[model samples]
Target: MIKREGYLIKAGLLFFFIFLEILSGRTIFLISSFSFFTTCVLSRQPIRQGRAMKISHQTVVNRIIVVAGLLFSLSEAYAAALLPDKQQKVNQEAINPEYYQGLSPEEAYQWFRDAFSESRKSTELFVLPETEEEISKRATIFNENLQRIIKENAESVSKGESLRLGITAHADLTQEEFQNRYLTLQLPAKRPEVLPELKGLELQQRLSALPDSFDWRDKGVITSPRNQWFCGSCWAFSGTEAVESFHAIHNNMTVTALSVQQVLDCTPKQDGCKGAWPGVVMDYSKTDGICPESCYRHYYSMELSCKKQLIDKCPTHIKVGGYASVPQGDDKALQVTLLKQPVSVSMEASSFWFQFYLTGVFKASHCHTPAKIDHAMLLVGYGRDSHGEAFWLIKNNWGSWWGQKGYVKVQKDKVNTCGISSFAIYPTSI
Candidate 1:
C-alpha cells in the first residue's frame, strides 16, 4: 500500500509538470515528459504494508522521472531564449534591408513563400470576428467616390495633361459654379488646429516686404513634380523637396533634384513606401547625406550599385524646419508667399482623379470629407484672372500628356476649397 501510494503521488506530480510545460509553449517536451511519467507510473505496484517494500524500484523510477523533467524544462528554456523576440522579428522582416537585399529573385521568392506559410499557420491559432460587412461598406464608398471623380473631372481628363485619374471635380459646374457651390457645402467648421494667427495688417506687411525674386531658383533649387504612384509616401516626397530646395538656395546653384528613392530605400527611421511624417525624414536626412538619382531610382529595379560615395551636405541655406503653420483666414497671404517659391503640399485625392486629366482652373473644396488624403504635389506658382479670381499653378507627374501639358490651375482662397493653403517651404537665399 505504501509503495502504491508513492507511485500515485509521483504520477500526479509528473502530470502537473507536463501541464506547466504545455502551457508555456513546449509541446514536444511536454509530450515526451508525459509519456515517460506514465510508463513509470504504470510499471509500479503497491507492496504489502508490513512486508519489505521494493523501495529501490520506486526510488529509481522517481529519480529518472525528475531528472528527465528537469532536463526537458532546461532545454525548452534555452531554446526559447535563442528564438527571436516578437519585436525583433518585426524589425527583421519589415525594416531591416540586410535580410532581404542581395538575394537572387528566386531565393527571395522562396523566402517570402516560407515566411507567409508560417504566418498563416500561426494565424489559425486565433479566432477573428467577421469583417465582411465593414469591408463591403468601404468598397462601396471607394467605388462611389471613384465614379464621382471621373464624372466631375471629365473635361480635365479629356485634356490629358496631368494625372487626373485619382482626383474629383464638381459635375455640371463651371469654375465659377464650383466656387459658389463650395461656399454652401456645410462642411465641418472646425478652426485650424495647428496654424498661427496673423492679423490682416501684419500679413499684408509681410507680403509687401517679401522679395520679388529669390536667388534659389536661379541656382537650380527646384523640385521635379512627383507622382505618389500607388504608394502613400507623400511624407518622404515632402522631406526630399524641402532638402533639395535648401541645397539649391544655399549652394548658389540650381537645386539639384535629389532622389526620393534614396529616402524611400535608405531611411529606416520611418515607414518606407507606406505613409510617413515629414519630420521623421528631416531628422534622418541630417545624419545620412542625400543620394544621387543615378544611384537610387524610385523603384527597386532601378537601384544601381552605389559607386558614388555618399556626401555629407547638411542643410546650410534656409533655417532647417518642418511643416508650416498658417492661420485659418490667412490663406491669401500664404498663397502669395508660396507663389514666390515652389512649395510641397498634401491633398486628398479621389480615385477617378488618378484616371483623368485636370486642366483649366478648379475651385477646391476643403478636405473634410471621409476620403483618405494620401497624395502630395509641388506648388509651382499662382496668378489672378481678369475677374480678380485667384488660381494656383500646379505641376503633376503622370507624364506630359495630362492637364496643360502637365499642370493644372486650381482656385485659391475660397474657404473649404483645394489650394486654400500651402504647406512646407524652403526660402531661396537672397
Candidate 2:
C-alpha cells in the first residue's frame, strides 16, 4: 500500500547509515544485504489499475547486480582505508667499488678527506693526529670498512638501500666509542583500527578520519635539527625539541630553541654526558622550566655541574605540564599524535647498521634489537612515496653532515621497526 516515493526515501536512508557504519570498521554484510533488499522492494512497486508498473524478473536481477557493484566498490575503498600504506622499498642499485679499487692507500686517504670537505675545516672535531703511524692506521681502517659496508648493503634485508661510508669526525673512533654516543629509547615488547554506526563509533570515527599524511615541519613547530656531538645528552635534546614543538602548537607562538644545556645542568642525578630518560627531562622542565640555549650553553659532552645560578640568571624560559607516554606498541596512535606536533622518541642507534644511513627508509631488523635504547631523536612527520610506500621522518641530533640534512626516514608500521613504537613520550603545554 506504500507509495513508490516512500519506498525510495526509505532505501536512500538505509544506504546512508550503512556507509557510516562501514567507515567505523564494521562488517557490513548484513547491512549490505538489507540495502539490496530495499532497492529490490523499491524496484517492484505494486501495480496500479490501468497502468500496471511491471518490474520484469530481469529488471530485479539487474537492480540487485547494481547494488552488489556499489557494495563491492565500497568494500574496496574501506579495505584500502584500514590497511594503511606502510610498506617500505629498498633501492636495488649495486655497489661501485671500482672507484676505490684504482686508488693507492695515500690517494684513498686523500679521497676520504675530499669526500668530507667541510668536516676537515672543523679541525677541533676532525683533528689530524701528531703521528704518521696513527694517520696510516686510520686510512687502513677507513678503506677496509668502506668495502665491507658496500658488501653488507648488497646482502641487507632492507630494500632500496642507499648507504655512504664517508669519513666522519668519528672515522678514527672505535666501535665502542660510537655505540656509547648513539643514545635513545627502545620499544616495549608489545604492539587496532576504525566507524560511526557501530559500538564505540566515536573512536572508530577518529581512526577512519585520520589524514593520509602529516608533517609538523611544515607548521613551523619544529626547530632546526641539532647536533649532540659526542655527548650522551642526546636525550636532553630530544626532550627539548618535543617540548618546543608542543609549546608552539599549544600557545600559537614561534618555535623557540630551548636549552638541552639547562636539562643537563639541572636535572638532578642524571649524567649530562651519560644520557638520561627523555620523560625525566620533561619532568624537570615541568618543575623548573628549561632556559634558552643562549642563556645556558651546551659545553661538555658529559654531565656538567648543576649550574643553579646560571639557570636562575636567565630572564626567560620555556615550561611544560609533565609528559604522556605513547602506548608501547601502537603505531597508528603515534602517527595520529604526530599530526598535532613532533614527538620525542628514542630507538636503537646501532653502530654498524644505521651509523652510515645516507638516504632511503631504514627497515633493517638488525637495528631493532639492542640491550637498551641507545639514542634519542624527534619524530617530526610521516610521509608516503609515489608508489604508496610509507615512512616516518625522524630528526637526529647528529649535525647536518649526517642523514638527509640531519633527518632520517625510519620504516613505518612494521611492528615498531627500529624500536620506534616501543618508547614514545610527549609533553603537554596546555
Candidate 3:
C-alpha cells in the first residue's frame, strides 16, 4: 500500500512536470526529453526499500522544482531574443497613394489626416490647425485637391494617357501657395548677351554611341536628391548636383554633395530664400568655389549670411572650370549633353498637375512655356516607359517623400515639355 501511494504521487508529479513543460512553450524534443527523464527516475525507484523510496520521491519533487525554475528562465531568454530591442525603433511606412483609391472624398480626407497629421508630431512637415476655422479651411483645401486628383485620374483613363496624379504631401496646399513657396527659380530678366557655349571635339567624340537610355544615376554619378523645403534654393540644389556629377564623371569617383547653402549664401545678385538663377549658382562655383556640405550646412527655412569662417575652414573638393548652355528649347541637345553628364534645367512646376505628380510619364495640358520656367531641377537621364512613351528622368530637390522618390519623369517633347529642355546647362569640372 505504501509503494502504491508513492507510485501515484510520483506519477502525478511527472504529469505536472510535463504540463509545465507544455506551458513553457519549449520544443517537442525538450518536452519529450524532460518527460523521459522524469519517467526513468520515477520508474527506477525500488518498491522493496519502501521508506527509502518515499524519501527518493521527495527528492524527485525538489529536483522537479529546480528543473522547472531553470526551464522558466530558458523560456524567458528565448522570448527575449525574439522580441525587438526597446531601443530599436521601426520605421514608418512610406506614403502610399493607392491607400486612398476607391474611397469617397470624406473618407480620403480622414485617411490623409490620420496618416500625415498623426505623423506630424515627429515629422514636422505638417502642423495641426490650432483654430477650428483653420481646420475647416484646410479640410476644404484638401477636398479640393482630392477632387482634382479624381478628375486628373479620370482624364488619364479617358485619354489613355500613361500619366497619373495622386494626393501628395502638398495635397492641402493651394497652387498659388505652392508656387510662391516652392517654385522660386528666378530667370534672368533678359538673356545674357553671350551665353557660355560648351563645344569641343572631345564632347562630340563621347556623344557618338549615345544609348537609347542613359542615366547618370546608374553610372553612380548622381547622389540622392535633397529637399529644398520652402526655400527657393532649387537653383543652388540643381547647380550643386550638376557639379557633383561632373566631378564624379571626370574623376571616376562616386558623387557626393557640395554645399548648396554655400551657393545660397555667397552667390551674388541672388536672393537666398526668394530665388536664384541656375546660371549664377554655377558661376559662383566657378569663381568662388562651393565647399562640401559639412563645411556649410543647409538650413532650408532661413538662409544665413556667407561666413568667412566656414570658407576658411572647409576646402572645396572640386571647382567648375565653366558652364555651358544646351541652347534653350533644344531637346536633342539636352539628351546629348546628358550623355556626357547630368545637366541643370529650369522648368515650370506651378500647375497643380505638376505639383501633385505621382509617377508615370508626366504630360500636363497647361504646362508653361520656356520663358515662364519658374523651377530648376537636375536632368539626370532619359528613357522610355513600359508603354513606349519616352520620358526625361529629372531629379527634384523636394525630398525623398515627394514624387517618385525625389524624381519625376516628364514626357519627352520636341516643344520642350514644362520647359525641361529650356535653359538646360552643364558644368565643366576642373
Candidate 4:
C-alpha cells in the first residue's frame, strides 16, 4: 500500500512540472522526460513492511516538485528584471531632426533676402488702406518715424530709400491704426559697438586648445533661431534647450523636438509663458517629471492647468545636476571642458548678436551700446577657422531660416561679458 501511494504521488509531481513549463511559455519536452525518469526511479524503490518508512517516497516527491517550481520561477523573475521596458511608439515626423536642417550656405542667403522682401510686401498691403481717414493717419505717422530714422543715420539709408520698421499687426486694430501706432512708438536705434583688438597671443593660445575634429550633426548640436511668439517664456525655452542637450550627451538620447509648452504649463516655479530660471525648471522635473510628447500635448495660458501625472518618473540611470557655468579667466580650461561636456549659456540679446552670422576673424561687439539681449542658448563645441582663429560654435533657437541656417560662430572670448560667459553641463558617466 505504501509503495502504491508513492507511485501515485510521483505521478502527480510529474504533472505539476508539465503545468509550470506550459504556463511559463517554455518547452517541457526535456524537463518532462527527466521528471518521468526520476519519478519511475522513486516509485520502484522497495517498500519496507510493518512500520512504514518515516519519510514516505510520496512526501519526498512532493517536496522536490515544489523546490523545482520555485527555482524556475526565481530564474524567470531575475531575467525579467534585467530586461529594459519597451518604449511607446512615437511618430517619426514629430521628432525628426531633418525637419530643422536648412539650405546650404549660398541657398540660405538667398532665402533670407527673399523672406525679408516678402515680409516687406505684406507690411505694405497693411500700411495703405482704401479708407481715407485710416490711410491719412497711417501715412502721417509712418512718414514721421521714417524721417526721424533717416535723419539720425542718413549715411545708412540712401536718398529715396524706404525705411523698414519691425512691427506686429493685431486683430483689434485696423491696418492703418496698427501702422500708425507702431510708427508713433519710440524705436531705439541699435548702437553698434566697435570691438577692440584682441591680443594675438591670447587668441592663439585658445585656438591651440580646441579639438581638430568634431562633427556637429553626430554630436546632436545645431543652431536654431531666437523665437518669440506672443509669450515672455524665453526662460522656459532656454531651460528646455539645456535639458535637450544634456539628455543627448549623457543619456545618448536625441529628441530634436522639445515642447516649450511643457516648460510653460508644467513647471510650477515658472509662470506659464511668463518666465523662470533654469535652476527652478530642473527642480520641477524632479517631482512632476517630464513626459514624452505622445503623453502630453503642448499647452499654454492660465485657463488650462497642467496635469502632473502624465510625465514619467525619473529614470534610475539618469543623473541630475545644476546648470554648469564656466569660470571667469579660465577660458582655455573652459574650452577643454566644453569639448567633453556641452553647457547652457545666457547672453543679453543673442538675437542681434547672431544676426551677422560672423565667421573666421570678425569684430566682437563691445557692451557700451543699448543692449537688446533677452535670450539664452547652448555652446556645443569650438574649432579654428581657416586662418587658425578660434571660434565658439553656438546653436540658437531661432528657426533654421535665420543666421547661417540656425548657427553662429562667435569670437571666443570677445563677448564674455555680463556672466554671458556662464555655461551649464551634465557630468559624464563611464
Which has the greatest lDDT? 3
TM per candidate: 0.46, 0.67, 0.72, 0.47
Q: Name model 1 segments beyond 4 Å from true.
A: 1-202, 209-220, 295-324, 351-355, 365-372, 385-389, 419-430
Whichever of 2 and 3 has more lDDT, that candidate is 3
Query: Candidate 1 at residue 420, lDDT?
Result: 35
Q: What lDDT tens digits, residue by residue, belong to model 4 across residues 1-430?
A: 7667755665665666565554433344336546454645644543232354477677567556545654564455444333212110111111122221364433432332233332222221223234767545544543343333234334323533221112111222333433232211111133112111123465456557566645345665432444433344555555566565555666665644455556667676445544445544455544444454334544332214665554443232222444433453345545655665565555544321132222232224423244333445566766666656556666665434334445555556454542345433332222
Candidate ranking under lDDT, highest first, comes to 3, 2, 1, 4
Query: Against the true structure, candidate 1 has what lDDT?
Result: 0.47
lDDT by residue for model 2 over 129-186, one digit each (tens)?
5488987887877676666666766765265443444334455455675776555343
Which numbered prediction scores highest in TM-score against the true structure?
A: 3
Give stretches of model 3 more than 4 Å off: 1-98, 101-110, 117-128, 190-208, 369-371
lDDT of all predictions: 0.47, 0.65, 0.71, 0.44
Give lDDT tens digits, candidate 1, residues 1-430.
5656756766665666676564544455476566556555554432223346445766566556655654675565556545435423542352222343566544543343343332222222222213766434433443444345545556555755232333221211233322322221111223223433245665676676644323223435565454443344556666677667765554566766676766766666454544555545555556555665544443331222433333233332222433343454345555554644566554444433333334445545424443234445556666665556566665554323345545666666464244234333332322
Off by more than 4 A, model 4: 1-209, 212-216, 221-228, 299-304, 312-319, 350-363, 369-373, 386-389, 413-419, 423-430
Point out where model 2 deviates above 4 Å. 1-102, 113-128, 153-167, 184-203, 298-300, 368-372
Ranking by TM-score: 3, 2, 4, 1
**Tens digit per residue, CA lDDT, model 3, 344-388:** 898888887788777788874557543468999999989898989
lDDT for 11 (candidate 4): 62
